[model samples]
Target: MDERRNRMDDARFDEEIAAEVLPLNRDLTLPENEKPRTGREEEAHIHERKQDYAGIGKVTGIAAVILAALSLFILPVFFGGAAVVLGFIARRLGARSLGNWAIGLGAVSIIISLIFAPFF
Candidate 1:
């Protein structure tokens, strides 16, 4: 259905944005030379970490997004609240893989939960 497609599109969009933002974010405090021994190596490291974050984030974000979306159709007993919390912690701890993702997903889960909480 159109709704499902829209959800997928949103997920994809979020993922792409996260992919871009997370990298620029990770190296914020580090000096260029200190980041990696060489430019190629640095790029590799950044790419590796980025992919890792993207994978984990996709899992967490997709889960939360699905649950949030389902809340509208099913019962609004929205799950994924925990994943959001984890993401926040990850974000705070410098675990880009976990943190930035958690923040975004947590926000979504919280918002959806608020919208659905009255139902349950």
Candidate 2:
């Protein structure tokens, strides 16, 4: 009778141990460094990459300024127009200083062309 009681107690204890330990054991099975990334984390990484390329407008603005400087007479009008457009785009894309410079240069080119239009 004692033997049968001891067997029953052992079985109950084994069941309790398994019930308490199964979840913890499962958690321990995975390595800390191998945890899966969530969707939000992936989106943040992509956003950082996008920011890295956001300064492309600065290049456009610089090119527009160069064109404006190289142009004279009728060409200055066209180059200045191009510079203004590029400046607007650059401003929209967050290149504040470059956009402002482009706009200023384009305006100066247009004024110069107008000032010397009768001569040319």
Candidate 3:
């Protein structure tokens, strides 16, 4: 009886495994009408992506600088903090020089504002 039960269990397990397996006849290849992208096309796509990032970086860097300048006049903590954050983001996106300038200006604005806070 034990031997018969063991055979039945093994058969059920095999059936479960077979049901889970993918069919061999399914098509895995791409359609013949579509061709793979050429190297130049790929490069152009990558270049375009880089340009987009650079543009974004430039914009962010400019905004950061503006915020830093604003910090010198009003709401120094808020504007300076925003400038610093945007500067770091711009740096990560490839505007190194602008990001550096933004960071420096932000820091200076914050410090100057704090120092003069008592007088105002």
Candidate 4:
């Protein structure tokens, strides 16, 4: 009886294995009209896709630097604050070097302005 039961279990396991394996054996090729993508083609496809922010990051970074420079001359507090905000925005958008420069320049402008404000 034990031998018979083992044979039954083996038969069930075989059926289960066959069921799982049959689907995987089907044809996986694309249709005659379609061609597979090469590595470079896939990369180019991804590169050509438009990003949400596009070139806004670099623009913000440039604007931040300009604001920081202008802050050194007039409306130091206002322009410096704007420059710092734009710098942070640029950093968040992937302009690390420009953002850092803008931040530094803005801080220096604000400090200098404050120091000279009492006299002028």
Q: In TM-score terms, which candidate is top?
A: 3
Clashing pairs in 2: none
TM-score of 4: 0.56
Candidate of highest lDDT: 3
Q: Write the per-residue lDDT of candidate 3 for residues 9-118, one digit (tens) a residue.
A: 56243433342343332233445664567999889988888888998999999999999889888898899989999999999888998899889989988888888889
Tens digit per residue, CA lDDT, model 4, 6-119: 886562444334544224322434556656679998777666643544477788899999999999888989999999999999988778888999999999999988888899
The residue-level lDDT of candidate 4 at 38 comes to 100
lDDT of each: 0.55, 0.72, 0.82, 0.81
Q: Which portions of model 3 show Cα errors greater than 4 Å?
A: 1-48
Clashing pairs in 3: none
Tell me the lDDT of model 3 at 65.
90
Clashes of each: 3, 0, 0, 0
Residue-level lDDT of model 2, residues 18-76, one tens digit each, is 54433433334535554555999879977886687576866766776676566544488
Rank candidates, lDDT, best first: 3, 4, 2, 1
Model 2: residues with Cα > 4 Å off, grouped in runs: 1-53, 72-74
Worst 10 residues of 2 by lDDT: 19-28
| Model 2 Cα shift for residue 70 (angstroms) | 2.0
Q: What's the TM-score of each model vs. the native?
A: 0.33, 0.52, 0.59, 0.56
Q: Residue 55 CA error for candidate 1 (Å)?
A: 2.6
Question: Between candidates 1 and 2, which one is better according to lDDT?
Answer: 2
Q: Which ten residues in a row have the lowest lDDT in candidate 1?
A: 20-29
